[model samples]
Target chain A: MIVAERKPLDEIEAMLASAERVLVVGCGTCVAVCMAGGEKEVELLASELRMRAQASGQRRRIDQVTLTRQCDREYLDALAAYVEEYDVLLSTACGAGVQLLAERFDGKLILPALNTRFIGTAEGPGVWSQRCLACGQCLLHLTGGVCPVTRCPKNLLNGPCGGTNHGKCEVNPENDCAWTLIYRRLEKLGRLDLLDAIQPPKDYRPMTKPARLVHPAFQTESAPPTK
Target chain B: MKDSIACLGTETEGTGSGAFEPKVVAFCCTYCAYTAADLAGAMRLEYPPNVRVVQVLCSGKVEAEWLLRAFEEGADAVYVAGCALGDCHFLEGNRQALRTVAYAKRLLAEVGLEPERLEFFHIPASAGTLFAQRAREMTDRARRLGPSPLRSKQAVESRKLVLPPDPHPPLPPAQLGRRIRESEEL
Candidate 1:
């Protein structure tokens, strides 16, 4: 799931300095599960902002709302009726959700309250570790289930780099060497032969930025001629 | 009004001399601390009237939002009183409350309020005197700290009727009460 962390309070306060009426929008999906952008977080933030404004005599009007999912157009449509009431919309969603809000509300100032961290999974309660880089490639079958692209800082697809110290990565001793994990898994499964085949340089064209996909059923040949 | 904010005593009961009387909110778990409070009352143990007691099912149920809301609603100081350490009715409710209090304290500091204004107390049902002492301790701390910064804003807000007219105007009293309570809990 997409992970995110809230921006510092000082940074958020600075963003709201000029906006008298601010609406805090929370995304109740991935970010919510990560405890970054959720209903409770929105309330906490709104309360903090209110107290700070009261302390400084700012006279600001801060409101909060949480959408089911901010990345989808249907959810973004909910804000259309009242978006005009606020000078700024502070979104506590991942980058995609924030950008979608910006696109939907083109005239309004939409700012991100969270920094999109990574595509990761929760390792434990309140702990998240990056698991995928979305490099438009999958070599997990060849290298056990681990993605060397993300787990290995060097992204060495062929095998472990010379820096694999025992079972730990040379760059960070705390991190387990991805290749070592792969080798052990393969040996256990008697699939170590998968490592004998050398992999060529990866093709990077698929990872080109701003990628999009139209469903096979939704593909249109041409636009109908306007009458 | 929804979930009754149990008030042990009235807020305006002054201590004379135009002194600032801090309004302290104490969330007591029913298993231990609340029972202890009852014991304190039976013993006629005299403690300051400034502290208001809110009884909850367990200290673990005392959420971070509740602690924050107390201050937001003009509480000078707030504390969660639960079963002492391992003696929690739910086995680990008091420990959970300890972590919650610590987290709330950091949040208070972030909002420019003194973290010391919020605390957690471990008081078993047998410790009636200790419960009263905790109340006294919080009240004294609140007195030394003075009124919370949020109180002045609350005073100003109270002077004016800020609530908009109810949108759905025709609910029964119980349902309306529940609705308001639900919103408050949110």
Candidate 2:
């Protein structure tokens, strides 16, 4: 899931400095799961903005709406009916959703209310950790199931760096050496032989910015009739 | 105050039962303060009826939002009672409650309300006397602060701060349409 955190109240207040009418839009997906941009957060932010605006003696009207998801146009249409009523649309979604909303709205002033953090998995009830870098390749077959690309601060491909102290990395003592975790798991699985093979440079083509993908099964136009 | 600001969608319900008596909402841990309150009643201890206890499985269930909502709904003061340190049934429920109150107090003060109106107590379940004493203490403190300024004519205006449903300086729907279309070219 994607992780995000709400921006400071002062910054959000600054964004609405000159605005008279503001509509805060919240996404009920990733940011919601992360406790950042959910329906509850949208209401909280809207209330705080109204309180602050009134304090300044400058009149501002605020409203809020939460969409099922903000990364697609279909969900955004729910907001389109009244989109023209407000001068500002403050979005509480991840960066992808924010960009998509801007693209769909075209003319409305769309601003982000959250700082999109990273793609990560929850380690515990309130704990999350970066698990995959989406490097467009998989090396878990050779180095155990642990990922070194995101775990290692240096993104080391081969083994632990010289800065590794015992099993901890020098980058931050709190972090463990990613290679050590991989090595131990592979050792326990009795797949140490896989480590003997050398790994070449990673392919970066699949990870290009603004990347797009279409599944082979979805290419109905060029395919022969199915069995 | 307008009827919209006069009421909050909170659990305190109704405009309270008449008179000018201060209303105190107490969030009590079921394992500790709730049991203590029961014991206080059984022991025939005396405490003001102004204090109302809302029970929870753990004091940790009392969120900061709930505390603020209590204030919005005519609570002259809010108090959270839980187990003493090192004795929470869920290990750290009381500690979590304490942290939340500390953080909430700052915000309460910042928003022109008395921070002293919010408090937390760590009373053991068997300490019925302490429960009654704390109840009287909270009631007295609230009486000293008088009613929430939100009730007075020289309004502090926290109620008016409720968001949504109320937008400032209403604009004509027709004007909003043309303005949005004109701005679209930018």
How many collisions per candidate? 0, 0
lDDT tens readout by residue for model 1, A1-227: 99999888889999887788888898888999999999888877777777777766676888888887888887777678788988999999999999999999999999999999999999887889899999888888888898898999999988999999999999999899999999999999899999999899998887898888788779787667799
Off by over 4 Å in 1: A221-227, B1-16, B154-186
Per-residue lDDT of A1-227 in model 2, one digit per residue for the tens? 99998888778878777987788889888898888899877866765565455445556777878777888676776666688988888999999999999999999989999998888988776577778887878777777888888889988777888998888889988888898898889899998887776677778888898787789988657677689
Residue by residue across B10-101, what tens digits does model 1's lDDT show? Answer: 24445667779998889999999999999999999988888888889999998887787778767889999999778988999898899999
lDDT of 1 at A189: 89
Model 2 misplacement above 4 A:
A54-58, A224-227, B1-24, B29-60, B71-77, B83-119, B124-128, B132-186
Top DockQ model: 1
User: Taking the true A–B contacts (Cα pairs closer than 8 Å), what share appears in each candidate?
Assistant: 0.22, 0.00
- Pairs clashing in candidate 2? none
CAPRI-style quality class for the chain A–B interface of candidate 1 = incorrect
Cα deviation of B49 in candidate 2 (Å)? 8.2
lDDT of 2 by residue, B97-186 (tens): 998898668656655579899999998899999999999999999989977654322212222112233222234567888989999977
